[model samples]
Target: MTLSENGDLWCDIRTLHPAGNHPALFLDRDGTLIELVDYLSDPAAVVLIGSVLEDIWQANKDGHAVVIVTNQSGIGRGYYRWADFHAVQARLYDLLAAEDLVIDATYACPHPPPDAGGPAHSLYRKPAPGMLTRAADDLNLDLSRSRILGDSVSDLAAGKAAGLPVGILVSDGYGARDAEAARVLADDGFEVIRR
Candidate 1:
């Protein structure tokens, strides 16, 4: 999937092979699937966390659609361009392809916070259900059986708002820092996976 010149998401719908209303594994890009690099734009900086790849591959083997739903505020913040994000995505796709793994779809929200002149509390950002709901609609996914994995509380919040069955916070990157806060999510039925 690629973002169009007008910043619209252009997914190759033909490539999506959902397994009959199967659940989706929504994932965050940085800190969750890859190394945490602030505003990463260079393809050379891309590094896959081995466990994430294994989990995604296993989910695919188990008949779950794997989709990457990320919040790319860097584009809105002027830290990087949309093309740069695509370049990194291209590298990521190549890497995953080499491993015989395919992500069903990818969605990114370039909008930043209202204080930064971006859309005010945009629904596309984390803690909102826009991206998840959009993907669910586009892919015919079963939200009631779906799960979301990330390293931040907002990721779980987004999944919760989207009515997904589960939200997992991996204990890597920002997870360690937010361990205490994650307890609240755990109380709310979120799972914390410690590395």
Candidate 2:
């Protein structure tokens, strides 16, 4: 899939959805799929962790089209360039392709805090619903039936604002207990995946 200048990702819609009734799987990059780093510019920093493809494949098999929604504030922070970020994402796509679990699309927030302005912040960044709205429009997704798998509070907040019913949090073995409990309390349907 390719991200157009307008932020819409192009894909073989037929390959992704034949019946056109599949639910969408929204994933947070960084900590959820791979180990979080300071700002991964080098492709060598890309690491595939713990049956990532297997899990995604299962979701796809169960009639879900997987999409990645990430917040790349590093681009806005001037810590990393957008070209380098694309290079890393390309490498990630190539690696995941080897596992036979190609992602349908990817949506990233490249804006920084200054660009965000106020509490409205980034329209495309997590904790906000901009990217998710774009996803819904581009893919014709049903937000109430969508599932967002994330690794942080911001991700959950984004999903909530987007009206996603389930928010699955992947614990990184840190101070996740309180966060997990809070998630369950906030959304009774939320899940916590502990590794």
List the candidates' TM-scores in order: 0.89, 0.81
Candidate 1, residue 187: CA error in Å? Answer: 4.7
* Tens-digit lDDT string for candidate 1 (1-195): 556465634343324663578788999889988899999999999898887888788887987888888888898889999788889988988888889888888888887767777777586788788889888888889988888888988888888888886788887769888767756766445454445
Instruction: Please write out the lDDT profile of model 2 over residues 1-195, one tens digit for every residue.
Output: 454575422222324455454678888878777767767788889887664556688877787778888877776667887678888888888888788776777887765555454224457766787888777777778887888777777777788888787777777422274376435536455444433
Q: lDDT score of model 1?
A: 0.80
- Which ranges of candidate 1 are over 4 A from the true structure? 2-14, 187-195
TM-score, model 1 to reference: 0.89
- Pairing residues by index, what is the TM-score of model 2? 0.81
The number of clashing residue pairs in each candidate reads 0, 0
Model 2 misplacement above 4 A: 1-16, 114-120, 173-185, 188-195
